[model samples]
Target: MAKYLLLKHYRGAPAAVNDVPMDRWTPEELAAHVRYMNDFAARLEETGELVEHQALRPEGTFVRGDGEGRPPVTDGPFAETKDLIAGWTVIDVDSYERALELAGELSAAPGAGGEPINEWLEVRPFLTCLPTVIE
Candidate 1:
């Protein structure tokens, strides 16, 4: 089976069909959205397609290694960055078509007004190591 990553972005994507910001959504709407995602994951898990899923906090720190014997450098939470990832799901499927279909369905998760967000999800395929050629 091939593995694919479904990236859910908080920004840096085109506006969703619903277009309403999550901060503007009502509490009930937020609950419903969470429920939809959970239900979707459960179904995928039952099918053995879901490998793992997780949600992330909106903020994150950027860390990089300094030269040896130096402390690692840390940057701000990147609030000003154009792209912010909100969550991710890894799926193992038989074909790319299946992966795309699943991503489309996930992008349909409910948003404000109890409507489909119709957002875009970034699909990335896992790379396999090439066979080594020995002389």
Candidate 2:
């Protein structure tokens, strides 16, 4: 099985069908959205496809190495950045088609009014380190 990453972006993605911001959602709606995401991951686990999943805080700093013995140089979380990844899910799937199917399912998670959000998720394959012998 090959590993794939499903990336959810906070910015730089096309607008979703249900474009209302989470802040505009009612408390119950927000809760339902969260529950839907959790349930999706749980179902993946049950299917033995889940590798790992994580949600990242929006606040982050850019840092660079500053030579030996020096503290790393740090910069602000630039407000003008084009893309911000909100979260990721890694899964071991048998084929690229399977990964695409899973990503589509995730993009269908419920949003406001319990309607499908139709969000876009960036899917990428992980490069394996193992060498393959050609037949």
Candidate 3:
């Protein structure tokens, strides 16, 4: 089995086919979108393919470690960020092909006008930790 991360981006990705931003979507449309995502997750969990999933708020902060004596430096939710990840899903599947197929299914979540979002999702595989060897 292999593990994969399905990254959903709020920005810094190609324009979606739906084009309408979530904030612009009507209340009912927003509910439908959320419901669809929840249902998808549920189905995956039942199939034992889901590891975990979460959605993120847009607000964020950046912090960096300072010298030992000093506290960490805190910074803004930069307007210049190249990418803002919206959320992520971790899935354990049999193969990369299955991961790709799941991502494609997720990309079809309903959007405005009750249509498929047809959004692009970034799929990444978890690096395997090799066993240590002793001479």
Taking all chains together, each candidate's TM-score versus the true structure is 0.89, 0.93, 0.91
Where does candidate 2 clash, by residue pair? none
> What is the lDDT for 78 in model 3?
83
- In the range 1-135, model 2's lDDT, one tens digit per residue, is 999999999988888998878888889888989998899999999999999999999987989999999999999888857588899999999999999999999999888888989898999999999868785
Answer with 1 or 2, whichever has the higher TM-score: 2
Q: Candidate 1: where is the Cα deviation over 4 Å?
A: 129-135
* Residue pairs that clash (backbone atoms under 3 angstroms), model 3: none
- By TM-score, the better pick of 1 and 3 is 3
Best by TM-score: 2
lDDT of each: 0.91, 0.92, 0.91
Cα lDDT of model 1 by residue, 27-114, tens digit = 9999999999999999999999999999998887889999999999998876757599999999999999999999999999888998
**Alpha carbon lDDT at 15, candidate 2:** 88
Candidate 3 wrong stretches, greater than 4 Å: 131-135
Each prediction's RMSD to truth: 2.6, 1.3, 2.3
